[model samples]
Target: MVSRMFRIETGDDKDRRDLLRRRLLETNTAASPVLRALRGTPAERQRPLHLWVMDEADELAGGLVGHTWTTWLHVTYLWVDGRHRGTGLGSRLLAEAERAATERGCDAARLETWDFQAPDFYRGHGYRETGRTEGIPGGHQDVHFHKVLAG
Candidate 1:
């Protein structure tokens, strides 16, 4: 046996984080044939898909921010102002985002919403609950949803 010494460190280090991500990507590509095939291809890159709705006064009414990669759309954020709620702005924003994602070659969409958020709203838009994490945010739950996009 050989003796060795190592020190542990942790913080918000961007360079190290990037290095770790690159290494993990390389390892996963080497381990998976599907990932290997995606390397260096256009589909390997995530494309941003953002949609915004503005009022006549130039104020933001609603918006959806997400990205598409490898035939899937990952919705990071979707929001509508209180005044715009129930006016169908949220639904319209989501529909436009899905349409754009479909145009980008995405076949599915996924997102997470807190229980206090619009889980039913997403379900109403044809998204189905795929996962749930309870006890989040003190007595609330985080719901994950997925939807198969129509061509």
Candidate 2:
């Protein structure tokens, strides 16, 4: 017979985050050994990238937040101020980011938006719907898109 001891803690511990990261990487590597080479990918190769527009005196107007890995740019968030929307600023920001990503050897870009968000706007930028899932609290669904760079 064999016995196992278990302990449960319900709180956030900053120091334990590193332990969780190690465990996650180990489990993934066990599942697929090819992923071992990505041990420090987020810190080394996939460091976050950002683009922003500023008004006079350097006040923030709009911006993007994302990271790149293995020739793919993952757009986590893209936003423009209310005063900047519909003024082409958002399109310019995204286009510039795509150009930069192409220069960095990225082959594609990906992002997600909701039903009420700018999915159609992304389509105008050459992104195409890849997949989607419905059933949010509201009637909105999460939509994912991808665009190939011209590099």
Candidate 3:
């Protein structure tokens, strides 16, 4: 039997990261017919979707930040200032983002919120709990939610 020798190193390197990402994309595209078909299509790329609410003084109140890719809107963050919570601003922002995503041909939306966060708010907005990860920070659960957008 023959043995091989190689070095396994890890660090934050931009050029290496880019090369690795390109290689992985190529491999995935080659392995999956769906991904191969998406190459060079608009739906293949993730586009940012953000909505912001401002107060009368032009300060930030609440916002939603996420991206749309392949018929889905992934909401990464949604936050409202403590003074603005429970004022419906968050709902409005979320609604607007969903509208824009639907216009972009998305049929579904998803987001993750901690147990201490707005799981109930999402439920009230017609989202359903699809899964959960326990033992998150503060010993809480990370809840995942999904909603079928009104397209």
Tell me, by lDDT, which candidate is best: 3
Off by over 4 Å in 1: 1-22, 39-44
Candidate 1 clash figure, as a count: 0
- Give the Cα error of residue 18 in candidate 1, in Å: 4.9
lDDT of 2 at 23: 71
Q: Which lDDT tens digits does candidate 3 get at residues 1-151?
A: 7879889998899998867866775777778787667636442456889888889989999899999976789999999999998898888989999999999888999999999999999999999999999999779999999999998
**Per-candidate RMSD, Å:** 2.8, 3.1, 3.2
The Cα error of candidate 2 at residue 146, in Å, is 0.8
lDDT of 1 by residue, 17-129 (tens): 86786677677678878766764744354678888899999999889999887678999999999998999899898989999989977899999999999999999999999
Candidate 3 ranges beyond 4 A from true positions: 1-27, 39-44
Q: How many residue pairs collide in each prediction?
A: 0, 0, 0
The TM-score-based order of candidates, best leading, equals 1, 3, 2
The per-model lDDT (C-alpha) reads 0.87, 0.82, 0.88
Q: Candidate 1 has which clashing residue pairs, if any? A: none
Which is better, 1 or 2, measured by lDDT? 1
